[model samples]
Target: MTNDLRARRLALLKEHFASEVAQEFDRTIATFADSPRYEIMPTGQVHDGEDQVIAYHRAQRTAFPDQRHENVRFHVADDDSIIAEFDLLGTNKGEFAGGAPTGKAFRVPTIAVFFFDGERLVNERVYLDSASMLRQIGRMDLLG
Candidate 1:
């Protein structure tokens, strides 16, 4: 029974990412618990509610509408939280972080630890290299 539950939860998580890669924001929104959150570690930013999460997604996708994860691999933790490692691929075809597009592509290695309460996802803590991403996108000069 426990294994069954674990598989179901993991399946839900994978499907969540599938929706996100498809740019199905509404579907991505449906995957969360009522008050889900995302903590982006590199940027020290947290989107703490559904609205904030929506805005964050909008901003990112607006900048890189083709953004997606590739070579995804998932590891199930002892606490049932799934840790996802993937390559974040995207082209900066639109404004990002209030800066004009460089129309460059970046491939950033990323890891996102998904936290769950029972079968509901409560939080996702993402670890990524902002410097590498910025440099690839022609924004390294902004790094000072």
Candidate 2:
């Protein structure tokens, strides 16, 4: 890809992350090329289309109101893909995964492969250390 296209992709990705952290759902959704789609690889959960993707974001933010990413690093995997590495940190302040709030915090390493159709994001496939996150948040039982 041309340098201009690469820069544009990175800019949009940064905007996407920032908007999510800011809880600006509209801005976040605007980054998509067409319909929003996200695949949580560890849980085999797919949030497809606009409504599902928005609902998924809402549920996650409700569960972890202080959710944020840290130590972000980006790798240009190809002309149409980018790999983002970061720590997904959050505090359990609300119900999550059918359990009561633990009032605990967790920091799990996460990787999100962002697929692009030209300059706009098409899908984000995330792989995270769910085991570590669950253990830290006092949900070891969920490991089974």
Candidate 3:
């Protein structure tokens, strides 16, 4: 609630995003509290705990090895949550959703609401337009 607390939370969120873009899963996981959770709102998928969270990250990175964020903006929603908006860009160089790579690149706007307990992150709920991403990557067939 204080200025110092907001600064600390923002710093932690920056570190978390940086580690993820670097594919440093260990460092990313360390930013969390005892338990970590991720929810992809568009897909209705939830990954909870360290193992599941790690696996989820692996799968996504495997599909988009060059995945990175751009034009990042942060909003302090409340004492316990922060919202992030950014452009997620990546090329499909590996299998995704049991389908072969399309050798295409896509950039989609995404929002992730980060929930924290004090300074440590507890959950990240992401919202993105999966249909737009799929269309851009020439994988709209996946929608069927």
Candidate 4:
């Protein structure tokens, strides 16, 4: 039963993210209804609903049309939560998080823990080194 749930959740994530974000299907808003509230930590940016998530992704896709997220690992917890590691790659072509356009390509590693309520994702807490991403895009001088 757990395996079935995991498979279903994974399938949902893959279908939503892959088709909506990766393929630029333009129906991202509708797809977000099945997703959890995603909060980008440290920055405290919260995308609460499917509409907001789609709007957020629309802007993101416009900025980095070539952006892609690849899931590298996934683990299902005893409580039905899921932990995933992924890589986000993209070329900066527009403003991001108040950072000016970098016009550079970047690859950043990220991890996210997703909590589930029944079959739907309730919340997703992500962890990543945004500083490294900034450095990769030549925005941060910390590594220089």
- Scanning candidate 4 in windows of ten residues, the lowest lDDT window is 27-36
lDDT of 1 by residue, 6-124 (tens): 88888888888998888787788777777869999988999998789889988999999999999999888888588999999999999988799999999999999998878878899
Whole-model lDDT, candidate 2?
0.95
Residue pairs clashing in model 1 are none
**TM-scores of the models, in the given order?**
0.95, 0.98, 0.98, 0.80
- lDDT to native, each model: 0.89, 0.95, 0.95, 0.71
Model 2 Cα lDDT, one tens digit per residue, 1-144: 989999999999999999999999999999999999999999999999989988999999999999999999999975689999999999999999899999999999999999999999999999998999999999998999
Give me the overall lDDT of model 4. 0.71
lDDT of 4 by residue, 50-141 (tens): 66766767777766778888766777788857788889788889877666777988888988787777666677777877787777878775
lDDT of 3 by residue, 53-123 (tens): 99999999999999999999999976699999999999999999999999999999999999999989999
The better-scoring model by lDDT among 2 and 3 is 2
With candidate 2 superimposed using the best TM-score fit, by how many Å does residue 103's alpha carbon deviate from the native? 0.5
Q: Backbone collision count in every prediction?
A: 0, 0, 0, 0
Candidate 3 local Cα displacement, residue 112, angstroms: 0.3
On a 0 to 100 scale, what is the lDDT of residue 131 in model 4? Answer: 82
Q: Which residue runs of candidate 1 sit more than 4 Å off their true CA positions?
A: none
